[model samples]
Target: MLDLHTHVVPAGIPFAASLAADDPRWARLERGTTTGDVLVAGKVFRTVPRVAWDLHHRRESVEAEGGTGQLLSAMPELLASWAPARQGLDFARAFNDWLADELPGHDGFFTGLGVVPLADPEAAAAELGQIAAAGLSGVELPANPPTAPLHAPEWSGFLDEAERLGLLVFLHAVGSPAAQWFPQPMAANGVLFPNSIGEGVAGLIATGALARRPRLRILASHGGGSLPAQLARLDFLRDITPPLQELMPEPATVSARRVWFDPLLFDTGLLSHLVTTVGADRIVLGTDYPFMPVDPVAVLDDPALPAGLADAVRHTNPGALIATLRSHVQQRS
Candidate 1:
């Protein structure tokens, strides 16, 4: 299986002790702790598992699960979302260089997705070359970048760079101010998190991003979040609502299908519906592994699913993306 939605934390943080409290470069892991209490600026951000960074353990787990390989993204918490532009770029370059060294080609089970500091789109655009030089396939950009707006006017240059490099832009959601409004963590993760992806989709369409940069390839996580469910409304309302009619240049579904989506929705009915909504070519198999105990391959294999879907998500769709990734690397060489 091409498990695209996996994450990794550094097995060890370099020089966590001396950095100033204001610097968010490398996260500080509490010394001598095996449980991975990842501290950002001396505060506990999140505790991750050994599967996050242990190659032997992770490869063994993927192999046991019948996975061919998985794409490794720096856990979103490590992305330095709100850090200063130069510092965030520095962190991303260093962090991603470390990830490039861990790819499956080096007897590990990871195909890496590099991180970029999207808070500064100009710096983020320039960082693509360094990311490519590190031999990474793509970038893990935040669905809701803290300082930078997602509108096309502000972000088209970054999109242009990604398209020029033939890079896959994985629009994964991270914690945002809206999540804090929820009363419980579960409500934030289960309700608010997925909906953030829909906002990303809306940004792409309403902001004239895809209209301006048609070749840009993106893969949004969580079954394109709420987009598959709401696209028909976007498609319908564009013709009637004056503001939406002006903002949306094409059918929202058309723009949505230009990107790929992961089938990590918890429901089979929703999965099947998504396949029909976006078509099989745009769907890829992605399990938030170690985070979700359920078997991703088995989810595709469920008798409830349409036949041949398992093979499509497992190989065909992801194979196309991987092919472009490797080709870009080869051209760089």
Candidate 2:
């Protein structure tokens, strides 16, 4: 089994200390003397786990779970894309360096998806080349960054650079002000943050981004969020609305199928809908490992999926993505 969506916090990096005194968007980690949990911006964020830093522990855990490989990206809070361009660049470089050091000599059990400082396009593009050179397959970009959404005009350069480098751009949702309008904490945090991926997809289709960057590889996490559920509505609006028709000449589903999605949706019913609408070949197995604790293998093996589709989601679809990842890992090995 291959788990595509796992995260790691680099050991010995004082992520919060890198920020200036006036920087308030992110909190520095304050390790507890007695407790395993680390406080971030005065709130208890998470208990630091050895698997988050220890390769031996992580490898043993994955082996026990029958996982052959795992892709490592930075934990979302560490992204700090909202910070100043200079700071963002520094953090990104440090993170990517740590990834390069940890990943290059290791066996094929681990592959890394590096990070970019989206606030600075030139720096981001430059770093993309460095990351590719470091033997990472791709970069994990925030779907709704503090500066702009994934498909906004400002992001075209970054997207172009990614395509040029043949990097798989994984769009993971990070919290934003717009997504917080739901008012209720649970609703905003749980429902809004995850489904914001839908907004990113809609923006991509409406802005003709997918059409423009045909070679860009985008893999959406959380079963493409609500895009699978909203496919028919987008198609209907595109057909009837003159403005949308011009922007989206083809059906939304058609453009959507061109991208890949992780089957991390909690609901099997929603996963079924995604498989049917997005095509099984475009669906890949992702567990959101250590965060969601859902088994990708069990989700794929559900009796609800067609037999062929079960195999495709479990292996073939992910193999398409992994094939690209393997090139980087093997190059370094």
Instruction: Point to the candidate with the largest TM-score.
Output: 1
Residue-level lDDT for 326 in candidate 1: 84
RMSD of each: 2.6, 2.9
> lDDT per model, in order?
0.77, 0.75
**Model 1 C-alpha lDDT per residue in residues 123-218, reported as the tens digit of each score:** 888888888888888898878777655664667788899888878889997657777898987678888767888888777876668866787889
Q: Count the backbone clashes (under 3 Å) in each candidate.
A: 0, 0
Query: Which residue runs of candidate 2 sit more than 4 Å off their true CA positions?
Result: 15-36, 178-187, 293-297, 328-333
lDDT of 2 by residue, 1-333 (tens): 667778887665444464634465553444443324544566766766667766667888889977788888887777776678888887788888888788755587888899888787767778888888888889998877767777877778888988887888888866667555776655766776567788887678777788778888898877778786677888888888989888876788888987888887767788888877878788877776666544544666678777787667666777778887676446644
Residue pairs clashing, model 1:
none
- Report how far residue 196 has shifted in candidate 1, in Å: 0.5
What 10-residue stretch in candidate 1 is worst by lDDT?
Answer: 13-22
Candidate 1 error regions (>4 Å): 14-20, 23-26, 30-35, 41-45, 104-109, 241-247, 296-298
TM-score of every model versus the real structure: 0.90, 0.89
